[model samples]
Target chain A: MFLFMKQHEFVPQVPYGTRDFLPREASQKRAVEGALAQLFANWGYDEVVTPTIEYLETMTVGVGNDLDQHMFKFFDKNNRILALRPDMTTPMARVAATRFKGSPSPMKLFYITNVFRYEQAQAGRQCEFYQAGVEIMGASEPAADAEVIALAVESMLKSGLQKFQIGLGQVDFINGIMEQSELSLVQRQQIKHAMVTRDLVGLGEILVKSGLSQSDQTLLKHIPLLHGREDMLKQAYSMVTNDKSRRALDNLANIYHLLENYGVSQYVDFDLGIIRDFEYYTGMVFEGYTPGLGFPICGGGRYDTMLNSFGMNCGATGFALGIERVLLALERQGIDGTQNCKGIYIGWNKENLVKAIKQADTLRDSGCSVELAVIPESCAQAKESQKSKGYEKLVYVE
Target chain B: MTSSDMDYLTIALPKGKLFAPSAEMLAKVGCTAEDLSENSRKLVITNEKEKLHFIITKTADLPTYIEYGAADIGIIGKDVLLEEEKDLYELLDLRFGLCRMMVAVPEALKREKLSDYAHMRVATKYPRIAESYFHSMGIQMEFIKLNGSIELAPMVGLAEIIVDLVETGRTLKANNLLEVATIQPVTARFIANRVSFKLKFDRINRITEELRTLLEGVVTL
Candidate 1:
């Protein structure tokens, strides 16, 4: 036996940046997905599934060349390039444009699936992660953006997260402010890079070197810091002179008012410098951050141009919550939970095992969780099994 | 966490050169510590009576700490912030620890124009910044990522030129390199977590105002 073990050694290992979930963790993850799926249904979103593989070029069309290298891609049997999707939004947009033509004006779809990326793994982050999100297509009003946010807030609250806030902003507004600047293309890119990276020092040097007036420099400098109440919008309103800036501010103000009407205002805050995914995102973009988590647990925004790239002209907005990040928040708050089942175990002696099986079927048919166990050799073993298996009740039959 | 941990406003400061000036600025806002640099082994420096705490971390990790809300505030350099690209509020430019990100070459290869090196081989820590800069100019280059001893890359023939931070030009001069172009100027900046800024508005605003006034005073002096 020792010689056989030495000759044919079995090594168990998964790929780096991937994870294997034990029983308890898998159950908890399912619970989180179930809750999100139910909420998506409640909000009039039907479930949809896209193929896990797609043509690499189609998936990489707007996902940026920087992110292209991170996607997991392989060659198909037909010598065609196929890549595992790094996100659901692009595939969903492709489907909405091609498959569902002439069916409905607005299509609401939700997915709970795994997306893979080639990134260094960290706590609450993985190369392969699960996402629960919805896509609302053909709606361009502030109402659509607010509804997406309302659903996100509701989903987070339902998942037992207490301390989380969403930073709301319009990408166009930042673009509008930059358009007002007379800085050359190179200088403007430098300044925008600084602001997006939250580098005040770099931003200031470029603004000063541009030789702008004190007020314009101040406005551009403070754009990243201008986040808060109605007054922040008022402050931004007083600064710009361009029409796009004016319209962007008005759109933001309208979205804010609409979110207030959605009754999720407490979970919403405004920021003028939310530049994440801004190039792909046209109007409203937001990020969800919970206390004590360095990365955003949820992020999405309005992408009017994405579907157009897929041969459709529909406006859409949606957000995806990271399943593992939500679970981390839950675990941090000590909220590891199962599917909330109360089961009764029916135990019987060997002579009456058939009777116990009948009883178990009766209980299960009547909407009760039932676990059946043949009588153990000792009472202690029977009781121990019942306790460990979370049986609410144990019935001993002769 | 202890009761003190719950109530105190936390600030994360970079551990090396930036800590002294950041601690000095925080001191002006009535947040001080007796042992900021006294013990290198310790991570957290605090003044419980003032409800202020500071976490010492690598410059690269400062944005992560602040973004995750582990610390309510952070003071870091523009280079680290740009490299990290975390979501946070840039409250003010504290304006110390200034330096320049420069594209440099060996002094022997100095007089040629940038276009002369059509196939530029560059080595530095800031690959993302360099990639974007070169991509904008339609220039082709090979990039190498190095953590330290970037000055050795050019001498060893690994890269023809290097993009690195130049503080006093002493290191560049010693390494037989000359600065060709400046990418951007960098300085220390005060930053806040976006969520914390809203939840702890009054204290954050008060501290920011105090630091701004103090910094203005320093400039005039």
Candidate 2:
């Protein structure tokens, strides 16, 4: 018998929650990452690399119980507890504080990396996923926030997404409202939860029970309805009583005005109820959504206080685009994925060997991906040879 | 791609008490609902004459169905919309099937501060909702996900607090629980698929306007 004997059962096993990227899938991913990288580079943000793993203690700062619970943790060779970074922003903060210490006042760095989380795999969400994002450090101005939002929209567009929206919210505004309320922490959380979920009734009840003035209660009820075009700012300012809350609203309005100036206003709308999931965010927070993807295609916020957790205090805002989700959106848009895969196939016959080798080498040197054909002559001439060989472009050398 | 002469408008109706009333509302807005009843074994109800279709789905999945273009318009709960955080238009409030999402615990546990249960087990179908709500409190609670009958969680020692939707406090009363807090008010809403809301503007707006009129207090309930 030949070396090729009976094929036993193909071990039907894959590492749970992780996946192998076949050629086409990988090419599609590369296309999305490449476009996003160029978009970030064009915006004068240099790329930075962070490790996939970090100390558990470092990654858990202000991440809260839910995300912290979802992180994958293990012990290192030195018996030190480590975690697969659940998000890039935290790691980026660590890097900025440690390595890039006192590098510059206004540092802008972009990153394309995979974050690991232990969550049930489903549509558009994976255990290990790739993200391409840009962080602008040392700037707390509305312009910096708008730049991040604009970059998010621009990057999504660069990846061929036309139908997407950015919902902007200032955490300070929402958190300010909560802070101003004379209620227990649980009540504040409950109200914030309701507001974010658009549960106006629960919000009303909470506000009513707190013994705040009717006007204050009414203002709180309008949080969910405080969404729409640029003109909504006037309405938002009218709701809050405190300067902090008003300032937060004004900050959002400034960001909106800046985006309008950037010609990207069409893609953004304000939602005061849109609170950031992370506790670190101290300013503007936003999420990018597309119809085709189940989760936000991108999410980022200003974490001015978080860097201080790493012993370096500077205001920063950034956003990360889910590369895999972008690729999926492009696919749904009917954008061709195979066009970039210029795969070539050549026969193994000796007479045609030199010619085939030369052509393959020349093509390879010219930046084309070509693989030598290893199919036997008899297999090539079989009844359904192409079905098994699966070559897209075939070259037969004389 | 060719612009087809025919256009099909799809609506995602949350699969609940609102489904039947929403189907009736859809009919008033010029769509057929002959089989929109929840008792019907149909997954998809279509009206070929009007080029309209309805996809009956889990009440919570209505937003996803609309956002992803699986359905063009969805009648979802304000609760689902609040929790999912998608970028869809809350075009109209159907104003039917109203309720409130509240924080409740065993009546005995009401005396304790909600923060007293910090890092303690809380059970709910809305983990994100519960987590975010608690996070905003500057306290954290561990979430134990349950589909239904969350009242059982407190009784069975699974969780200390139960976050759920309550209509009249009757369910909680029956379960020996008290409303420790309210999160938000809940109502059925008409959510539009972003692209469909734009591309099918005229037709969608017409239907939405009709439904809005009917939903308005102008009509006698």
Candidate 3:
């Protein structure tokens, strides 16, 4: 026999920070997304799909230019730049502002889609990832915020995550503190940046330099540490004297009571320092965390000002759950999220092909998953195929 | 996993100088583990009764462990945190292992300012910190990454300047290098994984409160 070898063996590789989900993972992801989509629909939210790419300026209007570096941008035919949507909320906001502006007062929209960001690849995170999220526009009350927070907890449960907590924070809490302080605008930004990054050392350094009173400095430094149950909220209320800060506390307390009505109060903690990275978040913010993952698996907040950029001038609140993160959390917690059902495999002798096909169709029509073999095989061979393919049962026709 | 195993609090400790003091501090909070010495070959030590696990890791890898939630908490140098840029809660300053990250030059070159040598070759183990510092100062320089013996780079013509941590000026003095600029103060800091900080809040808060009281006592004394 002549040896026939190719000159070069091809090796397949995915692009940096991207991945291909093989069968098992793909099925699990699909199952989770389906569950979330169904749940969102059940909650009275309509599904809205947007284009994968949009004008760079449109994305900047929602997320700001800080995230411009992370976006995947390219030139269009007219030399205008277009970017892969870094987040679905911005695109969802765009759709709401332009398409659904005059339709109604409150438009509840949900999306299950991939968002692109150039980030350092890690477990439970990637450059191109999937997010299942919902946005409620035009409702500015604490109820809207509470509904999204409660829905976020429900989304985690729907994804089969049992142990997780939602850290609820109001940006206005800190904003109120900064408003009352005599520090300059630059100082406020620096302090907020430190708090957002959870850099307590940097925060202390800035507070020391800020000319606020000793008690004010102590109160500002204590904002991040003010996290716990309802009692912590009561304690925080006593710590700040500013009306804005007190109002923020009241907002959190109001949202907490609503969460109790939703029966998700046990899952939330008052994290007064949770100024999310997104500058668009102008109101209450929250992040969902499970034990196994280092990062927040889901996060969102109220951004009442984002729609004004699109000229709609509506208030909005929403949350997004990282699909991969939910799956990873499920795996780590030893919970199987994928319901793989291998119903039956049908095989046949040379003349039994038609019969086998009929049997498969019958089983399928009866709501059982069935796979029919293409070529003829012995009963033993058919059994082997059935066993190897993980089918629960086999039907042999001779 | 046993119910007790589920409650086990894992802590990542850096190897070398900070190891002893870190373990001692943990002991004060009643989280003592066997085989936790720096000289021990075991990477992991456990206190089964107390439900605590201590992982001995390289100084740079400490944050990686905590950030991935492999370890719920860690004690690491601020310099490494600055370089690694991992997302973690800087819980408390441990107030020990103090040092300063300094940009140094060979005495013979006699450069007083970083801008004086605009296009010079700078060597460092911390490329990220050095690059950002240089960029902030609008100075462009080639970088030579060295693992150890950073002072030797400037002495042997490998690089004109070096950026490294200085606990004392003794090493630079022996190597005939002069400190040019101080980047920032370095200290061992207590850090926690973001998820663990919430999930194990009560346990972590107890230890943090204890340590805070201890540190406050030290400060007042």
Scored by DockQ, the top model is 3
What is the alpha-carbon lDDT for the whole of candidate 1? 0.81
After superposition, the stretches of candidate 1 with alpha carbons farther than 4 Å from their true spots are A1-11, A336-342, A345-352, A374-376, A387-393, A396-398, B2-7, B33-37, B40-46, B58-64, B77-93, B98-209
Instruction: DockQ each candidate and list the results.
Output: 0.30, 0.13, 0.53
Q: What lDDT score goes with residue A398 in model 1?
A: 69
Question: What does candidate 2's lDDT look like per residue over B1-221, in tens digits?
Answer: 11111277777777768888787777787887566677768777777778877778888777777766677777888888877877566766677788998899887877667677788788998888888899999887889999999999999999988999888899899989988878888888877765455445467767866886776645675
TM-score of chain A for the candidates in order shown: 0.91, 0.90, 0.96
Scanning candidate 1 chain B in windows of ten residues, the lowest lDDT window is B1-10
Angstrom error of the Cα, residue A188, model 3: value is 0.8
Report chain B TM per candidate.
0.92, 0.90, 0.95
What is the lDDT for A51 in model 2? 82
Model 1's DockQ score: 0.30
Instruction: Estimate, for each residue in A1-398, the C-alpha lDDT of model 3 and write its tens digit.
Output: 12554457555668988999998899999999999999999999999999999999999998987799999999999999999999999999999988886897798999999999998999888999999999999999999999999999999999998888899999998888888878899999899889878888889889999988999999999888788988998898888889998998899999999999999999999988787888899999999988778889999999999999999888999999999999998888889987666889899999989888888888899999888999999999999999999989899988
| Local lDDT at B40 for model 1 | 54
CAPRI verdict on model 3?
Answer: medium
lDDT of 2 by residue, A1-398 (tens): 33555578454656668887897799788877888888889899899988888999999874756688889999999999999999989888888888889797788999998999897776567899898998888888989999999999999888887777888888788677767877688878787776554344456667778787787677777665566666677877776778889899889888888898999999887866666667778888898776545456788888898888888888989988888888876676666644653566655555666777888898889987776665434435532443355655666654
How would you order the candidates by TM-score, starting with the best? 3, 1, 2
How high is the CA lDDT of each candidate model?
0.81, 0.77, 0.90
Ranking by DockQ: 3, 1, 2
Preferred candidate (TM-score higher): 1 or 2: 1
Error of 1 at B84 (Å): 6.7
